[model samples]
Target: MRARLDAESRAAGFVSTGVCRPDAVPDIAAHLSTFVDAGRHGQMAWMAERMAWRGDPAALWPEARSVVMLAHSYAPQHDPLSDLDRREQGAISVYAQGRDYHDVVKKALKRVARWMVAEAGCEVKVFVDTAPVMEKPLAQAAGLGWQGKHTNLLSRKFGNWVFLGAIFTTLELEVDAPEAEHCGSCRKCLDICPTDAFPAPFQLDARRCISYLTIEHRGPVDADLRPALGNRIYGCDDCLAVCPWNKFAVEASDMRYHGPHRAPDLADLAQLDDAGFRARFSGSPIKRIGRDRMVRNVCYAIGNSGAAHLKPVVQDLCEDDDATVADAARWAVERL
Candidate 1:
């Protein structure tokens, strides 16, 4: 059953697959409590809201006997950090460069889940990031990879550029041995962070993280932190890009995830109204930030770019309906 499920997962485009008991993540609850108690999750209050479900998968679904974890690689074809030098362009994270992974990975998860139900005659539930499940620890427990010092899963086969999805089933499948940590003495992921978001190895302070500030964070970002944002207008991938394990990373198999969307021109992005923003990032994950938040991030990038040519573009947004956007535009104009 385990072998068949693995084969089905690979046939469905997932690059990695493994199984573990639903109760495999023994230390997750304690680790999560420590992280959240330290206020590391920042404004992601949702993490604190569903304490039981997020901390324990068994608690989430008691009927589940096993959890099958799957990983889909979305590694960049070129250097993910190369766009930081193009100050005039806005650096969007590699993950959001194409169609939203939730939609893509969810569809793939459903396909695999349906197959599991059909082949094994077992009940199943699929989850792809949106759920309260702690996928990293489950993935680690399932031998997909160890959670690296950056706190993201890194596999010898696929590195840190993979999207995780899971299938919980009533079938008692054999579990795989968990992957051991291979980070050794490497601190490259920790050192590369512009805002020093990591308090120590394998921990993150999301409030200072560029990805959180630009995406999940609401309202005005700290003026001091804004300068360090550089040209990254969306999510930041500094830690992921600098990881030594990425040497083994493969190019994304999904063609939709490849392209110039990796670095869009700040000028063009700054001019986007609500409708234009929706149309531009229609199927992309960047759309989730909405126009105001997206433009706010662009303004921060414009300010950091030091490109005088974009001053007028920022000025035009000075009176944006969203206070955050307006504040960001004013800040950009002052900086430019």
Candidate 2:
């Protein structure tokens, strides 16, 4: 069954797969509570909402005996941070540069999950990032990877750029031994963070994370973190980009959302209305942030840009109906 699981997962475009008992990660609840109690999850209230189901995947569906974890690669072919210098262009995270990963990964998961039920005559449930499942911890428990010092999964084979999907099944399979931490003395991922999002090794403060601020964060970002945001309009990948294991990352052939193209123009992005924003990001993960949040992020980038010519672009947004957008626009004009 494990051999067939690997073969099917590969055919479905996943780089790797592993199985573990639903209760493999015993400490997940403890870890989650600590992060939330410290108020480190920031504005992501959902993290605190599903404490029971999220902290215990076994409780999510009591009948499930085993969890199948999969890794899909989206490793970049070029330096993700190279665009930080392109002041005029908005630097989108590589993951959002192509098709929405939730769509792509969930479709593949459903495909393989259907196969699992048919072959094994067992009930199965599937989940992607949007679920309460703690995939990073589950993935590590399944032996696919380890949660690195930066608190993102780091795979020896696929590096830091892989997406995780999970399957819970009644058909118990032989579980693999969990992977051990290989990060060693490497502080590269930790030190590269522009906002020092990691409060300690193997710990992340989402409040200070650029990815959280640009995506999950609501309204205007804290004033101090605004400048460090630079031109990142969607999400930030500085920590992922600096991992030493990435040297071994296979640039995914099937994942080609990002390329050698220069960054998208920030001035152009700041000018987008809701309709234009939706059209531009129709199949993108960026669409979820909505135009107001996206433009608000762009306003911060524009302020950091020091591109005097773009003053008028942001000036037009100073009166945007969205209070956050208007405030950000005013801030950008002042910074200029």
lDDT digits (tens) for residues 1-336 of candidate 2: 889989999999998899899999999999999999999998888889999999999899999999999998888877989989899899989888888888889999999999998899999999988789999999999999999998999888889899899999999899999999999998998899999988889999999999999999998899999999999988888999999899778667365456322378887788888999999888888889899999999999999998999999999999999999999999999999
The true-versus-predicted C-alpha distance at residue 229 of model 1, in Å, is 0.4
lDDT of 1 at 280: 92
For residue 15, model 2's alpha carbon misses the true position, in angstroms, by 0.6
Badly placed stretches (over 4 Å) of model 2 are 259-262
- Pairs clashing within candidate 1: none
For every model shown, the clashing-pair count is 0, 0
Specify the highest-lDDT model's number.
1
RMSD of each candidate relative to the true structure: 1.0, 1.4
lDDT of 1 by residue, 1-336 (tens): 778888888888899999999889889999999989999898999999998898889998899999999998899887879999999998989999888888888888999999888888999999988889999999999999999999999988888999999999999999999999999999999999999999999998999999999999999999999999999989899999998888888666577777447888999998999999999988888888899898998999999898998899999999988889999999999999
